[model samples]
Target: MDNEGVFVTKRSIKWLATLALSASLPAAASTCGDQGVWLQVLGSGGPEVGDQRASSSYLIWHNGKARILVDFGSGALLRFEEAQAKIEDLSAVAFTHFHVDHSGDFPALVKASFFSPRTAPLPVLGPSGNHLLPSTEQFVTRLFNESSGVWPYLSDHLSGNGAYPLIPHELASNSTQPTTVWEGVSAKLSGVGVNHGPLPAIAWRADIGGKSIVFSGDMSGRSGTLEKLAQHADLLVAHNAVPESARGVARRLHMPPSVIGTIANAASVTEVVISHRMLRTLERKEETERFIRDSYKGLVHFANDLNCFAVP
Candidate 1:
């Protein structure tokens, strides 16, 4: 069956029913149990040092374990440590794009994992490359390629000589359809290509514990792939990097509040979490919320570092 049909299936119908029933209850704060699913923001800000917020990063907690890491941006290592997350516990590492603000701390996590007892190959998924950006595999190789990588000392990760092997999966950067990146007993991940100017990018979706959450990553909302992927999702973590008045390159690279609201409303997501907050957007919180509310009337939240949202 087609991807769109997957959402209207009997199982998804029941899932939506559950969300509707739970709509009246408030989502618990920073609480997720062994039987529940939760999303934690490791870094909610963009590439601005003055904001005192980390770059784009997130963690998916399922069955009391940090099963999926969305991105390991700058300063995310400290946040990971503060959250008490173990790199050994992650089922996979998924990257939306290779921007510094989105993937600066990857080596840190790999080095940290060297101290863990894990020996299983780690799956790293990202978008395919273009002339402007490296593919996921190329990006990993450039990090520890033994002969030419900046950190040749850590080449053991690429070679089999390290604690574990690094497995890289590069999804098509132009495909509008969702591509499955990882799947386990209870956790499944998929990504769809998104427009981030010349940079290849993806928007990810995770289904675990019968709940769904979609991460918009950093997209301009020109491809419309995110809406299809986020259809009926329990929650959407979208970037609020630009304000409504933004134009030129800034407007082309990031989606403003209006686009985010339209996508959230179109996807029928239960709630929306506005993250990847930049100083420009943060300064106009009231105006941003007003623009988002013009089209989406559901629960809206402004994210912060270490803030957790239970997937209801």
Candidate 2:
């Protein structure tokens, strides 16, 4: 292996050119079936601007209806509409972190939901905060707190005076074990703390209709907490933000392909979906897939905006 831990071969040059060309093409139309649980990629790109794709967001569909939302990054609102999802149909919304790319469009979603028919309190769950980050409740309060919030007009949502109140649930950030955040007749949600450098972050798992799907968020994989939450999951949505050669702060914030592979392998997940694509990792798709395959023998899919996968 090279210094960056990337496997270097004589065919690397030829492969790079081919993979880059493929990466530039528009993603093919992929839609999930209508009969069971489905995962839809709302925003496939990361925090970058040039990718044309939106930032990180995801939707979980159960029996043709959107049941849960995993994140609401930039441009995700538009994608949600395009996917024919209804805010009223969502049982809860879980965030991986409070990063702009992961939660920037939250207020926008709340604003849009004003027109929806949902009357029940919406459950919003996220990680507990440390000194560097605000807790989930604090994050929501700072956004909609009546007196000092950025959107004071919409503060009624927090005060139970709006169309529907928002109930914020904060998962402990120091715990590696999964903690249940929300539970319903057919759906149960859990989360665990993850390593995202100094930022407070967590990964989410949803169990619905006898199927399990885990979102890895933007973890660096150093905490080793994801394995327990993702164990034996039907689908794992892992972030492929940086290449194996990435180092310094980039390495500290996001997991490389090798770590993703190891986690999926160790967790024994059925399939892996890699999202949070950035320009840096887009052209290096082949190399990333190669490293992930080095450890994980299961299915690996590179995510695209609007791409859908049915849980089987």
Q: What is the TM-score of each candidate against the true structure?
A: 0.90, 0.91
Please provide, for model 2 over 120-230, each residue's C-alpha lDDT reduced to its tens digit, 9 standing for 90 to 100. 889999999988888999999999999999899999998888889999998988788998989987999999999999999999999998999999999899999999999
lDDT of 1: 0.86
lDDT tens per residue, model 1, 1-312: 000101112544553543454355454354445658888899999889898898999999987898999988999999988888888888899999999999999998888887899888899989999888899999999999999998888999999999899999889989899888889888889999999988999999999989999999999999999999999999999999999998999989989999999999999999888889888877776677667766986777778888888887
Q: Rate the local accuracy (lDDT) of all candidates.
A: 0.86, 0.88
Q: Worst ten-residue run, lDDT, model 1? A: 1-10
Best by lDDT: 2
**Cα shift from native, residue 248, model 2 (Å):** 0.8
Clash totals for all models, in order?
0, 0
Candidate 2 stretches with Cα past 4 Å from truth are 1-30
Please report the candidate that would top TM-score against the real structure.
2
